[model samples]
Target: MTEIEKHQYDVVVIGAGGSGLRAAIAAHEAGAKTAIVCKSLLGKAHTVMAEGGIAAAMGNRWPEDNWEVHFRDTMRGGKMLNNWRMAQLHAQEAPERVQELEDWGALFDRTDDGLISQRDFGGHRYARLAHVGDRTGLEMIRTLQQRAVALGIDVFMECTVTDLFKDGSGAISGAFAYWRETGTFLAFEAPSVVLATGGIGKSFKVTSNSWEYTGDGHALALRAGAALINMEFVQFHPTGMVWPPSVKGLLVTESVRGDGGVLKNSDGERFMFNHIPEFFKAETADTIEEADRWYDDKKNNRRPPELLPRDEVARAINAEIKAGRGSPHGGVFLDIASRRTPEFIHKRLPSMYHQFKELADVDITKEPMEIGPTCHYVMGGVEVDPDTELSAVPGLYAVGECSGGMHGSNRLGGNSLSDLIVFGKRAGEAAAERASSLTERSGVPDDVLAEAEAEALAPFDSKGAENAYTIQADLQQTMNDLVGIIRKADELELSLKEIEALKERAAHLHVDGGRAYNPGWHLSIDIHNMLLVSECIAKAALTREESRGGHTRDDFPGPDPEWGAKNLVLTLNDARDGVDLVEKPLPIMPDELKTFFEDK
Candidate 1:
């Protein structure tokens, strides 16, 4: 056997998406020789899939819109379960971060006065999202990628991290990874590691996320001795294509509604009015005329039906479909085609139009779009203090969807973009600073290296006749059936059992390729990440017996204040078969932002 080659760096970033790119850039700016390793090509990380816009309180459209109001909306929309500090910091810094993107050559849509244009979104108190029509994520990522290349940060594309290396004291050391193009293992010995590996949307059957979003960062951190918090709260995007099984469950951008689309059922009736939460009731219009009037005159009133948070909207849609009010296409009608000219609609949501055309063979310009909820974002991840982005483990960090607490229970549309920018930079800065303070005199532990090597080669060596594809299919179906939009104790228990069985099957999974650019082998490895993350979500779901945010349990139909006051913690058990769930105390906000939570 050939010896594994090891290289040293100040910091290693384990993703190349929006947060990973931004984190790598920040580490480099902090005087660290940083490198980014990801599972896809440069500029192709799932960040490119975000179609809506970035939430920022730039006040370009309305001067009264500021970070304070943004913070209030975020906390209230999330039902006040958000970390007050992270929310405050995000609202305060997002404007500057957005401006920085502008300085880096990101071309957001412009207002009449030449400042960045803003758009209305669900759960927002005002028009706070800075956008580039649609394709905002593509614009942001492209800009960041350009900046990262210019900074000369080493980028290893199409690489996936198997595990994080830790020393005797259990502090994070670095990571071990293999090249997808070549079957070579290279050890990255960095004092600090930042995991910007995104979310676990792939754990479900219907999802807007791509193949790369398998919660790799959370899995890596958990194995390396970090804790994941609030894994129960998984966001289901309310608007995804729901017809033609092939394109079913793919996200249809919420930006369609932001641009003035409306939702209708089979009988051609607007239904969001029947499901408006009490929180938005004060601002919501009671009638269709009122909703339309509120839409036309945003300054005077509010559009409650169109303004529900993702969790509420998704649940509402699910209820409608279950009641047989769904359109013939197994979804509700998103009627934008009749609301505006095709030219204007295309300008606002170019990719949505193109995606529907190519995948569903429908033109959004002339037809009402069919949409339903799909697993979208996760609000649970590596536990961190809102300001530092540091996990419980030293020298470890997390950002983006993989690191949670920013969105609280429910994530507002558009906030994820700015959340990535704000916290991604924080993690990079903190990791670089932490690395600067530490000495890398001691090398990687022997057991850690041995375990990593075994993991890296096991797929090739396994001749047990298990198919990774078959196992992966079962996993997705299991998660979808047991842990989907509506949950119950019996279903969650079965989901855990099914995950354990699937994981057992994974050990014997045999790949057909020799690792050199072998997608099959890559998937075999990725399934481990998916299994671990799905378990985390399952175990956390089993523990939290309440209907709050994204975690709605049918058995426990009401939101309990006692359950609401804590974070769900998932720690790895002995066999790594599953995680141990615990209810940890939620962080008390600093004095300045306490009122923003809307506490009575």
Candidate 2:
């Protein structure tokens, strides 16, 4: 038998990323003894690598900009598939959250008035993203990390949570985890658990997320009987490195465009103008005159061509790259050198400049950077009430990139940071309030604990049957091949077969190493979650027969009105199986929205 270990906390938070840290602090402040368990050092979660700014209506640039406008922008940016309540709540609370960060010692870039500055980003109507230059996520994560430490919350670094412990009545009481350094099993008992584990980019071959993003929270929450929604709409950021195949998938920040960069094909033709829709065409500039005019005029008749929604821009770039109009690197160029001074470029986008210089040996201050689409964020995750952020399972809570129904179809460029702050606090508060009500320890079910242990050890017993590296590579290749930017029914069917075979093989995979921070051993376990998540995404993609937001199908081809009105939900159809896709109606905009206009 595997060694058994147990521990307790008032609240056990899985993942020490930005959202997890935020949740722990909130839980601690709510008078719960909270503990944060993570897969890395306390401050090194992928959140620190976020390049764009946090979306907020701080009104530093324009006093007229408010939460209502922020809400409208988010709705339209998401192509109107957003849960309006969550959107509304996120926009309204974001300003306070940004200020809350400042109070916790976050020093955002300042405007002439000595207030936090905002920047223009795709999907947002105004320059409303409060930023710390371009490394806003790093600032946000570090600020929150400091506060979490100051609050005296217990942090378990280098710990991987393998299982969630539930009581006899099916309530989650704690979790089962592992120490990466020593390869030891540790169990955590808490009245409540919050899963803030981020996006699932590692599921694909080419992605912007780090290896940590293997859908751990999605898998854990589902195992604990929670409902996950919208696992289908993974956002493919329009930019990523493209040279060395090993790092071709790292994210290229959107700030390059916001700082006046333009997408150019190998022939040097700007491509975004061709894709703007007729309804937004008048509002969106296709010509240089209009593009220049809109930027200068606040209530301009035309929208800046450079500020096109992320989906439109990404699709346009994809088409250009596919038609053999791409640069030598199978990607397009994002040119910023001609638009700004070297000093300004370095000051505003220091990390981006440094990343390219170090990683790709290209200096952005001189040459245009190469970029292509890469899977970055998942808009679909476990469903929760917009107000409370609680999942279908009573004791289970999800936030950050793990929780879903907030970003509708395609997430807007800068909304993810705000999504983390707004909902992270709500989930923390709700989980704490729920934990407070449970005055006594309900017994942690041993069977559930044992099941988790069994799954974790399957790789050890099966010797030389399969390779972890090969399974992961094949799984990612399969996802990238079939479930990428463009999809077809037959290709998706083929992909499903590959996923099933990978799972069966994973059951017999072998890792010839001790569990002491063995990436191969850990990856063997992470593959299970990725496979589960990939199936839901592919299945949901196959079910939705039309083009809408991030989900585009070549066979069905166009957006269907019926499909537009509903959200795709994934949950357990049976206690024995994993996930099943179902459709739920999206909330209609009230009579006021037509006049108010999203992103107004």
Candidate 3:
């Protein structure tokens, strides 16, 4: 029998990104003996890759900007499919959270009057993102890390939790994890478990997500009897590096367009105007002159069509590419060189300028960037209560990118950062409270621990000749090709069949070498998570016969009101081998909140 390590905590928060750190802080402050378990070293989470800024209705740039307007914009941006309560709470509380971060020493860029400055982003009615130049995520992480350290929060770095354990009553008891360095099995015994693990982007071939994003939290939630909502809505960001094959799919921040960059086709025409949807025609500028003037005089002119929601823009770029007007590299050109000066570009977008110059050998100050859509974020995740961020499963809380319903069918840029802090704090506080109410921490059964250990070591014992890396690569390719940004029923069905075959291959995966520092062993485990979540996405896409936000069915080609009124929920099947999906009605918004959408 392999010896297993054990630890006890009032609350155990998984993942160490923006949401995890924030949740740990909130839980610690709420008097819970908290421990944060992360897959990477502290401060190296995917949160650092976020470049645009944090969204909050601070009214720093425009006094007319407030939570009401922010809420309206969020609902509209999500195509009104958002969980009304979650959207309402996020908009109302984001300003306070931003101020809290600043109070905890996050130094945001300031206006001329020394107030925290705001910048424009897609789908927002006002300039509302609080930034630290282009490295806003880095700054936020640094500040949060400093606060977490000061609070004396416990952190277990480079630890991966493979499965969530439940007690006899079906409540979360603990989690089974392993250290990456030594591959030692460990169990966390806690009354409350908060999953702050981020998105499931690594399931796709071309994505901005790192290796750590293998849908671990989502899979854990599903297996633990929690439901996942909106699994089909995957966000393919409008701008990503398309040249220099080695650097393909790297993110190009929306801050570029937010500042002044324009999208052009091979004919050197600003084509976003021609692709504006009817829903946004009243608010988007149709002419080049009006759009240019709107940058300086927003009160008089409508915003540019280039600033349309990400789904629309990504589809427009896709349309332009298919029509043979794409750039030489099979992408469209994003020209900031012609719109802004060298000094302005460097001052406002130093990271982008450096990224292009270093990675793709293209200087943004003098030339255009070849850019296209790349899988960025998933709108679907573990379903949770709006106020507490607690899932249907007791003692299990979820926040950040791992939790669903907050973004609805689509997520607006910058809202992700705000969602992290707002709901991170909420989940942390709620988790701590739940822990305090429990008489004692639930114990991980000896049999459960042994079973988990055997499962983890199965790859080493397998005699089958299957490579984990090959299976993972094939799965990524399958998802990218068949169930990508544009989906069709026939393709989705084929993708499901492909996923089923990959799952069979994954079961026979064999890893070589000792467990210590074995990357192959780690990937073999992650492949299970990727395969599970990818099936949920493909399954949900096939069931929903309409286009909305991030989920676009090419066969359907447009949004259907009947489908818009429902959300697809995925839960673990009885056998625990596959997922079962069901449609549920969307939560209704109150009359007061509904008034915001009446005129628009």
Best by the lDDT measure: 3
Model 3 accuracy (lDDT, Cα): 0.93
Better of 2 and 3 by TM-score: 3
Query: How would you encode candidate 2's per-residue C-alpha lDDT over 399-458 as one tens digit per residue?
Result: 889998888888887788888888888878888888888767875666767777887877
Q: Each candidate's TM vs. the true structure?
A: 0.97, 0.96, 0.99
Q: Considering lDDT, which of the candidate structures 1 and 2 is the better prediction for this target?
A: 1
In angstroms, the error of model 2 at 450 is 3.8
Which pairs clash in model 2?
Answer: 72-599, 73-599, 230-380, 283-303
Task: State residue 395's C-alpha deviation in candidate 2, in Å.
Answer: 0.9
The backbone clash count of each candidate, in order, is: 0, 4, 0
Q: What lDDT does each candidate get?
A: 0.87, 0.83, 0.93
Q: Say which prediction, candidate 1 or candidate 2, comes out ahead on TM-score.
A: 1
lDDT of 1 by residue, 179-200 (tens): 8788788788988999999899
Residues 261-344 of candidate 3 have per-residue lDDT tens digits of 999999999999899999999999889989999886787648888788899999999899999999999899999999899999
Clashing pairs in 3: none
Query: Which runs of model 2 end up more than 4 angstroms from their true locations?
Result: 294-301, 445-448, 573-578, 588-595, 598-600
